[model samples]
Target: MDGYVMRLNQFISHNAKYSRREADILIEQGRVNIEKTKANTKSVLLEGQRVFIDGKYVKPKDEELYTVIVYHKPKGELVSKKDDRGRRVVYDTLGGKYMHFVPIGRLDFASEGVLLLTDNKKVAQSLMESDLEREYIIKINGKITEEMIRAMNEGIHIENASTGAHQKSKIYSMTFAPFIRYEIGKNDIHFSKLKVTIMEGKNRELRRFFAHFKADVMDLRRIRYGWINLNALPVGKIRFLNKDEYKQLHQFMGKIGKIDSFISKNNI
Candidate 1:
């Protein structure tokens, strides 16, 4: 029964859209099976054992086959499945079709825009970990300072980027890369509006960046991620990547050594 052995949760996670953590919850709830018997938390799988979740048999899928959805997330919604504080989450608005999709990177509860969610774990993980540019339209409470422009152009290292961060954030320090580019919309003593592009997605990065200058990020919205744009997508709606978008993604992935890394990670 054992050419190679694996944990029940790992099997379900690799075979389905659920994460390893979500797979564990499914097993604990008695929703998974191995070799036609209900599985528990400690259940293990042999190389050839069959697995079923919710009455459907599943197996490892390595075809590079998957789907991506671009969602125009709205502010005030958490990126989580459910919130501990009972706040609305993206899933509540994302609806049933994308119940298990993994978000590429988070936009935080207060920010919104071209959020990418995919059914493929590898795609989601790869994109999130990549250094692709993220473009944003943001408004800060104070005028754009010359010092800020210098910092953006030359990049800056902060010992403790302390303010404007989420209360629960444990990130005390960060090194920000020079912005790819920036364009000012309006700047005055009242507030400054600008569009900036950068390739880092550290925790509450925009907020923290402005905070370092004693400015508050008044309104922050992401306009683009890599080659995908928010375009005319209304808030709280989702769309599939068009043919051109998929082609761009595929080409990018191919050059990014995606195939070899994915093969090695899955031990295929």
Candidate 2:
């Protein structure tokens, strides 16, 4: 009974995986609610009360400020927060205060690209949703045929059935068209490059898809996640995002930001 009410933006900043400014926007957009009442920027409440945003309940996180960082995950480094084998972790290579951030999504030991690290659980969960398109560039051995490309475009049926041949198959839809479809270009006679976009980030899905045709993947890299792109970023360097970029991402997801100047003021 002694807790004091806090501003909607502050509440969201504490509970959700967004910045204070982003939380303010969400408040203004009426995505937040308290006990079924729509929330405004000035709305406030004490602790231990029910609050919801984007149809999901919100609560204070153990950690403050949901931070997102993009790391140029190098091959051979484990993507896990901690590995029992005592091998080097991607976070270790960061060697900064941001090293404690959790990766938004997974990148296998051999694959590398713009991997996202964030303390914001909600943002991480949102990015992992299958609705968000993630793009990757894959280099592989063996010439890909037109028929194979057609199959990829149409979506390949991955069967995990352990029974009779007449059993129904599970159809996974293709989210985006291949950049360099089936045609074997003039680059290499036997090897080819392809850019594929996937909404579902299934484990080793890309490798398995190519393995069906006996193609060996030489390299794999994630180039984009949602509207965020990795442009000319060095292999082992990461760039902190600016305010506008963060704002656009929240807006795209129907979320809003309140403190518009948080990024500009902080010069992040």
Candidate 3:
């Protein structure tokens, strides 16, 4: 094959408005077609083959001229398209143009700050999985003790690191790398403030790390992702990546072909 070849479900998940699981369901229901022929869940798709779902033509993903945006996610907003419990989702505020964009990772419901979104799935996946620096400001209950500093310097590896994890999270064991950098802003007995930088975006990493120290994070806000900074962006607002930012992004993405090897060597 000289061009794109992928499973029918994967292609729908990437280019259509459905999750992989949802795509599988649609295929089982015989709602998807390729060149007017009914398709199965395990069907292989090739370049130039037309794909449709429920009689709606699926647009191919754009390889050129895509849009990226920075959203100042506010607290209490879920980083999802729809929440089953009627909780507010980012799309409720970012409706219309950005409705279909893929969010680059997530900021949990109670935590908020710089959230990135893009119309291109490849760009979103690259940025989400890349070993890029993420900076956050956190306020945790209790003092920033020597043990906390030592753990930040040495990192943590635990088999049951689920204290700060969501109840539904099945990921029990996790590997946290040494923080790239950390600085304490306050050291009060009741509460402390600190800024931390790390390359790993594992699930609720900060919450879990501080939880191991018996400190609960009260406030967490992300301020930066790699070269992209929140700067003066107000809460619940969205802005396009400036030309220079886009240039820097593409430059970073250009080197991601061997990203697994890169992450392995870098301890992200």
> lDDT of each structure?
0.85, 0.68, 0.88
Better of 1 and 2 by lDDT: 1
Instruction: Summarize candidate 3's per-residue lDDT along 1-268 as a digit string, tens digits.
Output: 5666888887887776676777889999988899978899779888899998889899887676678899999999999767889999998899766666889999999999999998787788888888899999999999999988988999878788899998899988988899999999999999999999999666999999899889999999999998999999999999999989989987876777467678889999
Best by lDDT: 3
Q: Comparing candidate 1 with candidate 3, which one achieves the higher TM-score? A: 1
lDDT of 3: 0.88
lDDT of 1: 0.85
**Ten residues in sequence with the least summed lDDT for candidate 3:** 252-261
Q: What are the candidates' C-alpha RMSDs?
A: 3.3, 12.3, 3.8
Q: How many steric overlaps are in each model, in order? A: 0, 9, 0
- List the candidates' TM-scores in order: 0.88, 0.62, 0.87
Residue-level lDDT of model 1, residues 39-127, one tens digit each, is 98788887678898887888666647888899999999999877778999998898766766878999888888989998777788779
lDDT of 2 by residue, 124-222 (tens): 766676367778888888777665677676766645312211123253432323433333332355788877777765556677677666677788888
Give the CA lDDT, 0 to 100, for residue 20 in model 1.
77
Q: Indicate the residue-level lDDT of 194 in model 2.
A: 74
> Could you tell which candidate, 1 or 3, scores higher by lDDT?
3
TM-score, model 1 to reference:
0.88
